[model samples]
Target: MPRPFVIDCALSFAVAVSTVLTSVIAGGQAEQSPPDWVGYLLLTVAAAFLVARRRFPPLVMVLTMLVSLLYFGLGFGTGAFTVAPALAVYTAITAKHRIAGSAGAAGYLAVVLLADRVGGQRDVSEGNVWMVIWILVIVVVGEVSRGRAEHLRAVAEQAARAELTRELEAQRRADQERLRIARELHDVLAHNISVISIQAGVAEHLMHRDPDKAHAAVATIRQVTKDVLVELRSILDVLRRVDEAGEIFPPSGVEGIERLAGRAAAGGIAVDLDVRGRASEVPADVGLVAYRVVQESLTNVIRHSRAAHASVVVNVDDTEVLVRVRDDGRGVPGDDVRAGNGIAGMTERVEAMSGTITAAPADGRGFVVEARLPLRRPEP
Candidate 1:
């Protein structure tokens, strides 16, 4: 059986035993003792009904009150015999049946007062006063218990809601982190693959017609492949053990744009890199964003733009870094400038650092990609 049911059974049994003891003791004190069976039967029924008090508190109170009245009607005095019914009153009140509990208490008090008057026993007024005091005590105790139970219930509900909120926030942050990692992998692999593709095509075209040019192209491919593998290893290391605090890849910034331009030149696209303002003073994340914007822009130029030349401009101030990548190639339509994964990836990185990016065709010429990234970190 459940623990609460065991406790209720014990309480009910105690009440029944106490009622019988009271009746026996009181009968011995009476001038002429009445038969014991009627009192015992009435108190026993009242006490037994209390076992189900939590399930039907008001019903138990009513049944106990009726049994108590019958006991009094049979000339049995109200001594500890009232204990069982009093407990029923408390049970009803604690179950939040206030109106029924109050009414039951009032009716019980009236019955005790009437019983006293009808008996014409000595000091009847004193007995009635004592009855009222006891009833008030029971009501106050029941109300206090109800208040405490309600307070505990409300506290439990608030705790459950707080836990759910914390779990949802954790899941949301994990999703964002996963997306950031995927974007990094895409950017790294895409640039390397584009370089390898251009180099491979050059080596293949010159392999027979010009042996020296083909050998150089093959050398370029080897260097680019080695560099790509190093970067890929760094990315994989970070993925394998994310909690480690060491640097995953070599630090990349706007200064690396020179090496990028050289690689683009080797791929047969002449790149002009221009710097203005204090580029070295830019924050690491801002500088990295500037580098990525230029890298992706040039990759696009080599793959799509048939024109021979592209220009990269990097300007920095005390507060922000500004970047522009323009190509003198067959420009895309304005409507076709909408975000694909590459453009969307750039936009996500910039906006995450509180920056802005715009990509569109240049006036009467090739395509342009411009970005402005804040030097200082943004507030959460």
Candidate 2:
């Protein structure tokens, strides 16, 4: 399933297959030359057992080393140079079962020397130095293979852990994105829907008493509801298919201020909009920040303010876009405004875009939210 596991499995399979094929060839040689086939057959069986050496190292070593002794007993000198048992020793050592490997090594040396003494019909003093040299080579290879396998396994484990961390981080980000979309939908549609619902009920109650006046109120409700649905769908479409091309638009720029004014007018909050300098000079992201600042400010006015009037001013200089929203209302409730993350969130967005926001109750009356956003994208 994962890369490291897949690679390890393939490598282990290859090693096992290779060991079996090599053992069959070495086993055939023993059968052809030796008179006592029993000892040679035992050596062949031991070598074949090496295929599962890693999974059952200590057992494989004991069984294979005993077979090696029997082959030596039957006068089979030197040869296969039995790479299989050497592999078994390597497996045992890598698994940190070095004591088992050491025991196998000691037993192998004893058998080789004893065989030479018995078969040659000679003294122990006349034993071949080459047998000792071969044993040393086996030990060296075993140590090297053990170290390599350990290093490879450690690296594989580290890689798997890193991959898992990345996957978890991606999932966390996806969850956060979903929450962002939900918050936007709730903030934008909920307030407007509340107003429309109340106004619709009022119009229904006055239908017979004041038909013409009631008709105007009903029309306003329809217009307000339609506008909310259109914008709601626009926001949802952006959330549902962020990956799709052509879904993007210039959001929260000069056009956004006009839309904000229109929405406030519909909600019975008279707004005066003032624009200065080049309106189109702001970057798209900065424009979006400007839009959000105005949007949140107006939304707060409708929901929290007692005053029926607000003023919006946009100043686009050479380097920055400054937006100011002032309301002639009993200044914003400190605790509610602070507890609501809207203002703080607006500041965060501005800072992320390399900008700043300041909000305070005006000197004599009402409240003001002013934001200065850089026209250029921040350096990466």
Candidate 3:
């Protein structure tokens, strides 16, 4: 059985035993008494009805009242039988049936007063006053119990909702972190691998015909690979200590565009970098986004555009930074340009920084990638 049912059974048995004992003791003291068995039967019936008080509080209260009135009418006892009905009233009130409980209490009290009047009992007003006081005490206690139970239930619901919110927030953060790591990996590896591939092909082609050219190509491959390894290590370090306070190295930003231009130059693309404003005044995160926009654009030019000459323009203002990369190459078909990872990655990064990126074929020839990043970073 459930614990509440067990407790109810125990309480019912205890009340029944106490009522029976009180009636037996009272019968011995009364001058004119009904049979002991009659008192025992009536009180037991009232107490037994209380076992279902939690499930049917109003009905139990009514039944106990009727049984108690019957006991009083039969002249078995008055005081002892009141205990079961009082407890039933308390249960009914605690069950949140306040109107019914109050009405039942009032009717039962009136009946008790009428019985006293018929019995010619003295000090009837004083006795009724004491009965009212007792009922009021039980009502107060029941109200307190009801309020406490409601408070505890509300607290439990709030705690559960808080826990669920915390879980969802944690999952959201994890998903965002995973996406950031994937974007970083793609951006870091794609450009360097393209440079290495082009350099290796150059070295192979010139190996027999021109020894010096071949050696320079080999050197370029070594340099590009070394740079890639350094960036890879930094990315790995970030992944390992994501919760740490400081970065492994200063983030690559607009200042690193010259090195990016050099790498593109080594890959047989001549890159002209033009700066129009005070690039140094830009915030680190915004600068990083600007650098990435240029980097990814140049990588796309090297890998897809097949352009010999390209130009990178960076114009900074007090509020925002504008970056554009245009290449003089056989540009991509509209569909091919629309469906590429480089553009998607650039768009995601720019949007995360509350910036915007656009990639499209130029008006006459080649392709262009443009990005605008706000200088004042938003509060995280």
Q: Which lDDT tens digits does candidate 3 get at residues 1-380?
A: 56877787888899999878766666666554744677788888888998898899999999999998898888764446778888999999888898898899989989888887888876456756888789878878888888898899899999999999999999999999999888878887898898888989999999999999999999999988888887788887778875445435435888888889999999999999998889888888888888888888889889988899999999998889999999999998888876978789889989998888888899999999889898876898
Candidate 1: stretches off by over 4 Å: 1-10, 30-35, 98-107, 114-134, 242-248, 334-336, 377-380
State model 3's lDDT. 0.85
> What lDDT score is found at residue 312 in candidate 1?
90
Decoy 3 TM-score against native: 0.90
In candidate 3, how many Å is residue 57 off?
2.7
**Winning model by TM-score:** 3
Candidate 2 on 19-41: residue-level lDDT in tens?
44554555556433442446446
lDDT of 1 by residue, 1-380 (tens): 56877888889898888888777876777553453787788888888988898889999999988988888777776456567778888989999998889899998988778777777766657656876888888988999998999999999999999999999999998899898778777777777678778989988999999989989988988988887787777777777875556435556687777777877887888889899898777778777788888878888888877868999999888878889999999987766676457888889889988999999888878999999999887677
After superposing candidate 2, which stretches have Cα over 4 Å from the reference? 1-88, 96-130, 194-214, 239-252, 344-348, 351-354
Ten residues in a row with the worst lDDT in model 3? 242-251
Pairs with steric clashes in candidate 3: none
| All-Cα superposition RMSD per candidate | 3.3, 7.4, 2.8
Task: Using lDDT as the measure, name the better of candidate 1 and candidate 3.
Answer: 3
